[model samples]
Target: MFMNLLRENKIVAGILTILRLYLGYAWFTAGLGKIQSGAFNASGFLGNAVANPVKGPDGSVVYAWYVKFLESFAIPNVDIFNFIVPWGETLVGLGLMLGCLTTAAAFFGLVMNFSFFLAGTVSHIPTDLFLGFIILAAGYNAGRIGLDRWVVPFIRKTVLKGKEPAKQHA
Candidate 1:
């Protein structure tokens, strides 16, 4: 059954691969810029900026709902978070480009986009596109033409074979 589904979904896998490549390059370029400009520390407007509203669990912000949400979890100096964000983007971009762990890469891309979207920076459209890309990666069979195809099948055959029905139907 699963093999039939995989056989029928070649086009979907291709499209997902293309989407992965495009988003991967986009994310890689963005992260590259941050690395070049030394902005990964997040001293810029978005990262360094403090979340306003200063809510006290009452869900009320003087400015915007988004601000309140930010105040709750968007504290700055997040040095560890800052350090990982850009590198994570870069690695995810590479993974997408190479079609290795493509689904996981897309998942991280979606998360990064969600974080940006929550910033209310008017780039939600692309973020939405990224989210869609993640869904596509999860739904389609991208492993056939990618590393996942080789690795996952081996794992399934070796590890999951025990769970499959016997040749004699038991």
Candidate 2:
């Protein structure tokens, strides 16, 4: 029922626009700061996350697999993360802000939010995740007042050009 309102209601879409803009601004600023720092490194953070993994109530590692992944793949490939994090955030911000690909933007934003949560850095993750899910659920309507209003239809027409069912003679 709530999802239906988010996806189909014009009034709700207007509200979502506000949330989208807010999330987009947050993402843009974070990425911009990292890009400008000229010393943004993920290795240190990844190492720390692995060292102090999220723990369960019993004091056992809650995400042992994630810790291992960070120690193995993430640390070894820190350079990739250094590049992807900033750039991906910036692109997601732009997409959401412009409402060009709002759903994709929200989706990626949620991914980062979850990654941060898994790394045991909650902060704004809960709120961001909540809003992102809302935007994602809203789908095309989320961007109905923005670029997706036209971009979606254009892409659909172009991609589906020859894939339509053939008409039969009466």
Candidate 3:
């Protein structure tokens, strides 16, 4: 019921647009700051996550695999992270804010939010995740009031231009 409303209702799209704008602004500012500073690095954050991984009640590492991943992959390739983080965030923000590819934007936002949570950085993540989920779940309706009104159809036509529906085997 609620899901249908979120995915189909224009009224709900308006509400979702507000959430999208707010979340988009947050991402854009954060990313733009990093890009502008020209000093943004992922090594420190990734190193810290490795040093202090999430632990269980028994003092055992809850996500040991994630710790290993950070240590072996993320930290080792911090340069890649440094390059991608800011650009990725900024692109995601632009997409969401302009509603160009809203669902895709929300998907990436959730990915980053979860990555942060996994790394134990818990500032504004919960709220971002909550709202991001709503926007993602709402699908196209979330961007019904924005550029998606035209962009989506254009993309669909361009991509599926020659594609035909499958024939039914009677």
Candidate 4:
């Protein structure tokens, strides 16, 4: 019976489940902490740029451009990003925790990681973590006892037309 397979598959599934849960907890905790603090409204990146001051050398205009971008774009939307980013993280965490559409969550989470990594500085962790999660979620039903087992199939029915999303890789 399928139950036998589920039990047999528990080891891999358990690991994935634990990973998802812990990562989700980490994300949610960070997001919630950010939300609790009053530091949300501060001009985040712009403030960093101004305070840290990444001055360009000689004829290089990169720093100036960065400053300009931070001042103009980043400063204006700091509040928006503060709100959106934390909530997005929280949602990703929740989805991953429940293993609901885990691949989708992992996909979006991967995107978030890439964006942060591209932003430069201390981004390697997120980049590596994202890739690892993607690898684990790829193929196989590590989500047997989690919501993903049901959600994925339903998604297949409604969206992909009974075709599951391709697993990432081995």
Q: What is the TM-score of each candidate against the true structure?
A: 0.66, 0.92, 0.93, 0.66
Alpha carbon lDDT of each predicted model:
0.61, 0.88, 0.90, 0.63
- Minimal lDDT window, size 10, model 3: 161-170
Per-residue lDDT of candidate 4, residues 37-125 (tens digit) = 84655465547655565434563444555566667876777877777777777787777778777766676666666545434435445
Candidate 3 lDDT over 39-121, as tens digits, reads 99999899889899988899998888889989889998899999999999998899889998999999999999999999888
Ranking by lDDT: 3, 2, 4, 1
Q: Which stretches of candidate 1 lie over 4 Å from their true place?
A: 1-8, 46-73, 127-131, 134-140, 154-170
Global Cα lDDT for candidate 4: 0.63
lDDT for position 153 in model 1 = 62
Comparing 3 and 4 on TM-score, the stronger one:
3
Please provide, for model 2 over 1-170, each residue's C-alpha lDDT reduced to its tens digit, 9 standing for 90 to 100: 67677777999888888888999999988998999997889988898899899998999999998888888899999999999999889988988889988999999999988888999998988999998998998898899888999988887789776354454343
Best by lDDT: 3
After superposition on all C-alphas, the RMSD of every candidate to the true structure, in Å, is: 6.3, 4.7, 3.4, 6.1
Q: Which candidate wins on TM-score?
A: 3
- Using alpha carbons, what is the TM-score of model 2? 0.92
